[model samples]
Target: MQEIFDENVFKKGIGRQINLPFLKAVSTAFKNIRVRFGRSFITIGGIFFSLTFLMSTFTNNVIAQSLLASGTDEVKFLLQPMAQEVQARQVWLISLSLLVCIIGIMNAMLTSVTERYREIGTWKCLGALDRFIVELFLLESTFQGLIGSIGGAILGFLFPLFVNIGKYGTQVIEVLPWLEILKYGAITIVIGLVLSIAGAIYPAYRATQMVPADAMRQEM
Candidate 1:
């Protein structure tokens, strides 16, 4: 009679043998971004434009004030009450755009999970664990978030600056609120990172639940 294999001992041995490297997951994430640029672009664009909207809303008044004149003292006094109203509206707009951004990211990543069914199975068949798969997707989102956030931040500030310079000349840059701008930029970047990662979590969990046999049988 054949000797029985101890399942628990076998599992312990396999666990000890597997070593997943962080660099490997990071490299795979970069490769996937390049190989799937079109999808990656869509995901990044959602974050990019959303952050752009946010940054513009954030600094619109500050830049406008520096470039435009309030006229007589009476005009400044008249607009004071209205500023709060305008800011409240902007807050609503920002909140809406960010919600859409989060949804867009989740949808795009879900698509990726479906598309990579065979790839996921191949990795699983080769002894890849669920944690490795999750890590790959998270890294992809992190990089996308970083690029989109930085690009959006630059464009958001530069576009406004260009428009103001055209309309008001160089004076706009001279009196610029650099400190406030930097603070908003940093805050926006953090938001982008958190949103990107948040959007990927569900899809990553879905991917981890895939059965290797079924996933491998998937058409695409």
Candidate 2:
């Protein structure tokens, strides 16, 4: 019995472990939930449609309006209606993309704060300042935002090509401008980073405000 109790007997077969910090933990949680729900990806697809339609529409609309205002024949007869339709679709698409981004950010931040309540409490009890904890949460949020932004960019770029390739046999897509992509990508990343941190701040602050004893009592 004593020989059977030996800890070393199983040591060779045991594996080492790695530790992940709070930020990484939050990111992983969001990643898992996003995958499991499958809605986030769908939202991303919606965003793609919205973004594409809006950009094309706006581009054509502005050109047509300018040409009309200038009293020029440069505006082709066929292009006006096509441009208007594209513009209308684009408006809807832009709106949808904005909605998706808002919902996604909220979901990620809300889930993160809910799951990490105990860990946050522990940090507070261990003499961590509220601001430090807030910064920690912010860092996690920023990382999440960056990841989402990158993913959105990749998807956004590829989506237009995917759609065009499917339609009209890919004879050099007349739609999908690079400038708009750049503008949107930058805006998306900044907004996402801000939204993520904003979402976490309240929950993190609440956790930090509790007394050490109270904080410690939280369940993992």
| lDDT top scorer | 1
lDDT of 2 by residue, 1-220 (tens): 7676676556532333123466654665466445545544443343344334444434444334543444224334534567667667766766776666556655655565566667666665554556665665566555555666566555655655555446323332343345755675566556555655565576556555667576457675
Per residue, candidate 1 scores C-alpha lDDT tens digits across 120-191 of 888887788889999999999999998999888878777877876675567667767899899988988999
TM-score for each model: 0.86, 0.56
Residue clash pairs of candidate 1: none
Candidate 1 backbone overlaps, count: 0
RMSD after CA superposition, every candidate: 3.3, 11.8
Error of 2 at 134 (Å): 0.7
Task: State, as a TM-score between 0 and 1, how close model 2 is to the true structure.
Answer: 0.56
